[model samples]
Target: MQGHGYAPPPPKRPSTGALVVLRVIFVAVPILSIGFLAWVAPLRAAIVTHRRADWWIFGGSLVVLGISFAYLSTDHTDDFSSPNGNVGMIILLLNAAACVGHYLYADIRHYHRLYPMVYLPPQAPAANYVYPQPPSPYAATHPQTPVTPPAPAPHTPAPHTPVPPPPQRPAPARIDQVRAELDELSDYLRKRDGHYDGGRDGR
Candidate 1:
């Protein structure tokens, strides 16, 4: 007799080292930027004065540098592919580009926040600063007269008619009388058939 064979178990999932590194970079960059904003007032002020493009470049550089550091620090064997030193360097370069973009955006936002008002373009003056007047007189001068309402008419009396009362029913006769009639009828029927029994007489 042949024996049954066992099925193979499922394969294990790969390590999440790369994903962990990516998440760390994502969270760390923003947190660091916020910290810098809070602690370094001079930097923040400088950012406000700088052109929008400059701020984008600054922010983008910081993010890219941070990501590059994360990539470089991760262990090679912990990931699926062998770690390439050149790959880490390339990521750093890409990060620099991203920094430039971020700086530009930040600079523009800072400028707007610090300086809300913008200069308006000049134009030729008109004949009059105020608009031409209309011929219509003031409404308060021609007040509407109040009108009084008419008095209501007197009410008329309704006709008087009597309504007939409903008929009253008499109370039912005694229950004993009804029972006695029933017993008499039953006795007569039983006697007619010659099967009458005295056992039901008391009931």
Candidate 2:
């Protein structure tokens, strides 16, 4: 007679607490970073003239928080571990990377936009300068000519042209030499006395 086999139990669901914590972290890290950036700007202005450190600190903290949240979100089950759990972790890491990247981009853009403005010397306004009156139609029609014709100047030799750079040569292969050196080393090592005498020496 054929015997019936017992069926396996259903998979266990994740704890509500773990899910709640994971969701909270997912939403909080970005929001916190934005808030920190906003708060630090004014504090930096009051404390330190240069606030690069503040921005960096805020960005780094957000990244750390994101990573911590991602780790906390990782849940492994005995019977049925969610394949998509790692996806959430990857997305969190990606978000952290994006935050850091955006911070760097903004910092760089800010410096680029401000650098020229800061370094450029202010221009002086022209003072006591009278605008030239437009020439009359008669004067414009008949232009004055020079009395004596100017002599042709002597020509000078052209400046030397730069020579083109030589093409780069490929580096020589040292693999053979390295192999020979390794073989020599192996030979030296093989020649050394063995500590264990072929399992013959008694301790």
Cα RMSDs, all models? 27.3, 41.1
In model 1, what is the error at residue 14, expressed in angstroms? 51
Q: Which ten residues in a row have the lowest lDDT in candidate 1?
A: 34-43
TM-score for all models, in order of appearance:
0.26, 0.24
Q: What lDDT score belongs to each candidate, Candidate 1 first?
A: 0.54, 0.54
27-141 per-residue lDDT for model 2 (tens digits): 4545566432332322322233256755565556556555545654666654224654555445555555555445444444544454433466877778857889988998788
Model 1: per-residue Cα lDDT over 154-177, one tens digit each:
898988888888986544666677
* Segments of candidate 2 deviating more than 4 angstroms: 1-71, 77-84, 117-203
Q: Residue pairs in steric clash, candidate 2?
A: none
| Deviation of model 2 at 117, angstroms | 8.0
Write down the worst ten-residue block by lDDT for model 2.
40-49
